[model samples]
Target: MPQAVICAYARTPFGKHRGALSGYSATELGAMAVKELLERAGIDPASGVIDQVYMGHVLQTGSGQAPARQAAMNAGLPVTTPCTSVNKVCGSSLKAAMIAATEIRAGVSRMVIAGGMESMSNAPHFVRRARRGEEVSYAALESVLVHDGLKDAYTGEAMGNAGETIAGEHSISREQSDAFAIRSHALANKAWDEGWLDKESFPVGGLERDEGIRPDSSMDSLSGLRTVFSDGGQITAGNSSQVSDGASAVLVASEEAAEEHGLPVLARIIDYATSGVESHRVMSAPIPTVRNLLKRNGMSMDDIDILEHNEAFAAASCAIQMVLGVSEDRPSDIPIPFRNPCTVLVRVRLAISGAPDQLSR
Candidate 1:
């Protein structure tokens, strides 16, 4: 059985909603990341070295057909290269990488490009039944981002409402949530200031750094914000994820292919697992999923040196920490130490092979 390893990784600096990256489409952003990733890996796009390309995209309302193909061709990949677009909502890109790794481990592919892209700034609005010419006097234009991407289709509730439910169930207070949000922003600022994040990032549209970090955020400022989801809700705009646009790409290649091409192995995929919970408890799914993954591999929470859990909402992050028994003393344990500006579907497990070093440049 072949093993899959990440040879290269690159992402565009996250642009705040309608900010620097607003002009670029999701496919264009994906193309930028894919181009840089191939260059970093020293692979020629026309050489047919890559067997496939998989890109995850959520808001595809206005984007043209075959998004992964559009991105690959825009990045100079050969038309012969296969492309797939995946959408598992918040886990879309990670699922893309997981599929690529599965194919490589099964000897179905030698080399693959896997990543995700999103342009919430460009998510379109449409009037329902407009195409069918419904016999209605007025049809309100609905936001695709809010309706298709952020809302729970099963329950017809916004994800923030789910966050509120999770917070209530887990006993996460508003103060705790606000503090976590502050820590996330502070850590992101620190990482950028210390030049740690720049190593894995590249310029896009002349934007050199993430545009969303608020260095001046504090408990006082966060406390004043009103609840968003429900009356007296714990979830607030300050504690929820920012609506940002960005793209990330990574080269997943078989160990044999890496050795042949002399590509540096950044990390190896040991094992991955997926689990689900009740639709309303969407944010809590990671808790059981992570536990199952560790149990299957005969590992424990203590064995994980750095867990990059996505902070979709500060409430969710607090819930996971409380339920998992993650040690607060562990150095750089989770996103609290390395939170990125874009808080959407970006999931990467960095368990280096030998000595655990900073993610290689």
Candidate 2:
């Protein structure tokens, strides 16, 4: 069956944890993006064309229906529309979109909304190693698990530790990682300056600016920072994407539905896949996913016009880039954009809080 087309897409500027959007709940962020997407498509949220609402969330603390339902209701979608919550780690949003597209292809539904939200600033924290609670006296055990107690069930470690392991195993040097991070910042800055992203982002609580771009960046200062996970480990705060708070949404509709509604198509997923690797080697999952995508399309790296891997960690990003035979170095042997990107953004926190605005040098 022909793929569904993306009618509209919108995202809150990924917010640095506790940054400008600390006050807004994830539902609010999702709702804001949903509303903007509908407006972009010239449709009202109450339009019954929407068949389902899928929300991707990793960290959440509250009692109620899934965040997807909350977001849909808050965005003013019809209450009768069905909703589902999906969790695929960072791939959740894309997966949700794919599912909606599949449903459209199967004649299950004509249109749907899919996307994600994560608020690291408000992520629930809990006592360390609740499994060890048995070792503590019975009287003291109950209180220890308080405060939305939850822990990583796999390694009994936090996500940051997993990131650290990815760095060490990949042998991604701190210098190299920091350099890649600077490039991300520079590319993002350029993308903003050139208006490549203007069409994709929405205002949140009146925030119009991207909170992540740094005006000043330098390499010298970045190379001097201390490592975060292990002594002498290559990864550092400068090279990692901050635990961010933000949300994004995209509208998908069948070709017939699009014609009926008079909506424009942005792009369609030609092919997509997801895989699971060892939890400790979580960063490696994308490698297989990309390979499968290429295999299915019978295409190569050179065929792709753009690659948007989540920069979960510098080490993970670099490792995947190299394994895929993608070059980070410029053809001239010098970084394409001239400037030290690390020092410029080490302290700049980006997040969702306002409308999209130009970031000047």
Candidate 3:
């Protein structure tokens, strides 16, 4: 029997600050959402309804004493509920949800909670060895580049300067990059206006609203912004999502379990697939990922009714859509894509703030 989606919820207004949400640890954020989800569904957190918790975190600021278990403990769930954390780059949380669903479907678990949390604001900045030790500094003082230290893994020249290389290699034009940034704010604003986001959003203590939304933006206003990657590079701060503090979680259960609990489900996770692309070209994964997923399910692009492509980089997104043959026409300021031969749909809704470098970082 197929597993059922008991319920799904995501908290953490995607933004760049830790202000009101500051004090809470990553485990705390996950726990808060997990608890809220159970309470809203009128389920007891400590009940056996949840058999496990799967969380996703990119940067661990040493908050969790066993992050997954910490989240479950914080949520007041049963101590016996096994928990774990998963990291799949940007796909962290989404993959976590899929894994929980798989467990329920396989009869290994009756119910599970899965999601991801990233608090980039709380992500600590590390000081290099030379900064921490005078001996290392003195040894390096004798020669330039003599520390024999590993450089930024991405660029081999420092992470910040690597954006220029990517921009040049990708041929991302200045105007095109800015236009993408503008579209993100506009589409995100539109999503809020349409109430499309209300379905998944759970209000956290600090964020009743997503801080990423920018209304006072215009192409002209963005034109004068300075580039951070290089002298003539296109990337800028306004074109990316902020270093945010938030978490999202969803519940899954076996079909029998959901029926017994009388839980309402959202969408079914029919299948999930991922791939390894050139790490620098990480954005390329969605293309192959979706292709593999559809292939495994015996489905095609035409079968999807909606898509939520994480707008990591505008150029990458544009490339993926073009590769998939997705075309959109914006009229009356409404953007709709050609979903299939028979119908038109919106392929992606953009949301951004900082430079394209933000994606790689």
lDDT of 3 by residue, 1-361 (tens): 6655645454555544555566666677777777876786778886667888888765664564677678778888988888898765455666777788788878888888887765554555433566665455333442111111112345444232433444455565667656766776777677677775665566677566566566666778778888765677665666544445667677777777777888755445566677876555555567788888888888977765444555434455455556766554421122211011010011112111111113335
* TM-score to true structure, per model: 0.94, 0.82, 0.79
Overlapping backbone residue pairs in candidate 2 total 17
Count of steric clashes across candidates, in order: 0, 17, 6
Candidate 2, position 177, lDDT: 79
The residue-by-residue lDDT of candidate 2 on 1-361, one tens digit each, is 7568777777777666578887887778778877877888888777688999887765555524688888888889988989887766555666787788888888898998888766656654343455775455444432211222222457665555666676677777777777877877777677678875566666676666567565355588678878776776766766766556677787878888888998865555455688888877777888888899898889988875445455456677777777888775521111112111111111111111111121221
Error of 1 at 337 (Å): 12
Answer with 1 or 3, whichever has the higher TM-score.
Answer: 1
Please report, in order, the local distance difference test score of every candidate based on alpha carbons: 0.82, 0.65, 0.58
Which numbered prediction scores highest in lDDT against the true structure? 1
Could you tell me the TM-score of candidate 1? 0.94
